[model samples]
Target: MEDLTPDLGDDRTLLLVDDDEPFLRRLARAMEKRGFDVETAETVAAGKAISTARPTAYAVIDLRLGDGNGLDVVETLRAKRPDSRIVVLTGYGAIATAVAAVKIGATDYLSKPADANDIMNALLAKGDALPPPPENPMSADRVRWEHIQRVYELCDRNVSETARRLNMHRRTLQRILAKRSPR
Candidate 1:
């Protein structure tokens, strides 16, 4: 497929944050072809550093990160570069998270593996050049439930550990998971 990444040269800049290195490189290259000056970070810490150090026109952040939540990165970007549009992408797409993202000022939320067109559409929509995309093709609630299951597995079913890793309270995590589990 033709690269849709913008070529910014020295002017415009776009920040891409994701733990997936291969995906990051491919997306960055594609975005670069579309005319944006692309900068990539494999972790939330690196994303924060880039946001603090440079001016960015837009940011595409993954919802989960190795060191921290992608939402944290979105929050940082919103605070540091309010004008820079933010798009949150997650493999575990969830309505609750999507709502949270919008509440935190994300311009859009997407589910992975998102394509170049998805990113392009989000950017254009943020600039008021287009309308919001259709409702997520996948069920957000189901995705959230699956994510909770993963967390539970990782924590060995220890609610506290899962909550700690997710940056949520033990009670909250338990409550969410409880709701998802069958009767």
Candidate 2:
């Protein structure tokens, strides 16, 4: 892969915000190898501080951080540096949140397990050009499981409430939640 340095001019700084420490470290290293000066934060407070103190030219933020939502950080970065490219990554991808992220100034919204290449492509994509389809798109089963999980979380982990909202039997919902996620 070619370095993105020249394409981005001198502003090669990148911010990576995620609650997953291992993922954050790995992504930071990958972005650095791709010619970015990377900085990482594991909480919303830290991410906000970095955005306010010294905004980067590009950012990849996890949607659900330990302290707060990543959209707040995206908004701050956008307000501080309007030209910055921001991508929101989430394990629980949903239409509503994706729209909200864009409205808050994110350049793109991607589902979790997205690779460094995907993130780089998102940041450097041309105006109004749609990102290419993911090489290994999530399976239908996986998508369904993710949706169920999202609803489960939204219902505050109340199994009965989630089942009711999804029009599913409580026992069935419990069984699904008990199983591991499909690929």
Candidate 3:
């Protein structure tokens, strides 16, 4: 993976924002090893401050921060540095959010547990390169679970509201939501 280091790549300053401290630290180290000067923030406010203080050449932001959506940081970065390449990484991935990220100025959208090499590839891809389809598509059960979780989050984790919006029984939604995420 070190071979992917951008010797001449425009990866000078990289802003990494995510609420997951462990993930953020690990990713920051990985990016630093890849020849990027990594700057990190655990909250949206900190991220916005960093971006405003010193513009970065590239950014890798989580979809949800401790305080707000990563889209907010994306917008701020785009406004401050229009040329900066920004990628939104999230554990909660959905078609709607992916579209919103792109429309909000994210160069790419990636699901979490992503490796440094994968993130680098996404950031550096030329127009000719397109993201490959999932190696193993989600099962129907997994898809349903993910959709339910997404709706649940959108409803602010209100079981009744989520059930109402999803047209599902409250108890059924509760049981499903209580279970762990599907592989």
Candidate 4:
């Protein structure tokens, strides 16, 4: 597919923020190959500092960072550069956080592991047009696992609290959490 590199402005600068070092490096390289001047950060603090110092025209930020929520960086970027196209990414995709990201000025929200193509498309998507559906959407079991994991993270990884909130037995929740996510 042809890249949709939108001419948002003269600034084709992109910021990529994620805690995953290898993923960050790979994405930065990919975006650079696509003609963007990419800057990267591994923590929310670093992301926020870079954003505040120099807000990029585009950004792909992970929802959770080692230091804090990526939403904080998003918020800062939006405040500094209102026209920026910012995409929020998360391995633990959750509706509440997606909505929150959008509410705070994210251009889009995508579940990780979103590819460079997907991230670029999201950043460049024009107007209100919806993105094409994923070729390989997650299975129901995987989705359930992600939801449980999200809730668990939100509850500070307290299995009992997560189970209570989910109205599931603690042991069952434990088993689910223990096992690898279903494909």
Cα lDDT listed for each candidate: 0.81, 0.91, 0.86, 0.90
**Which stretches of model 2 miss by more than 4 angstroms?**
1-7, 149-165, 174-180
Model 1, residue 150: C-alpha shift (Å): 7.8
List the lowest-lDDT window of 10 residues for candidate 4: 1-10
- Residues 14-113, candidate 2: write the lDDT tens digits: 9999999999999998888888999999999999999999999999999999898999999999999999999999997789999999999999999988
In every candidate, how many clashes are there?
13, 0, 0, 0
Give the 10-residue window scoring lowest on summed lDDT in candidate 2. 1-10
Report the lDDT tens digits of candidate 3 across residue range 56-93.
98999998887998899999999999988888999887
Best by TM-score: 2
Ranking the candidates on TM-score from highest down gives 2, 4, 3, 1
lDDT of 4 by residue, 1-183 (tens): 886445546788999999999999999988887889899999999999999999999999999898889999999999999999999999877799999999999999999878887888888888898777777777999888888988998899999999999999999998998899899
Reference-based TM-score of each model: 0.67, 0.82, 0.73, 0.77
Between candidates 1 and 2, the one scoring higher on lDDT is: 2
For candidate 4, what is the lDDT? 0.90
RMSD of each: 7.1, 2.9, 3.5, 3.4
Q: In candidate 3, where is summed lDDT lowest over 10 consecutive residues?
A: 1-10
Query: Cα miss at 183, model 3 (Å)?
Result: 7.7
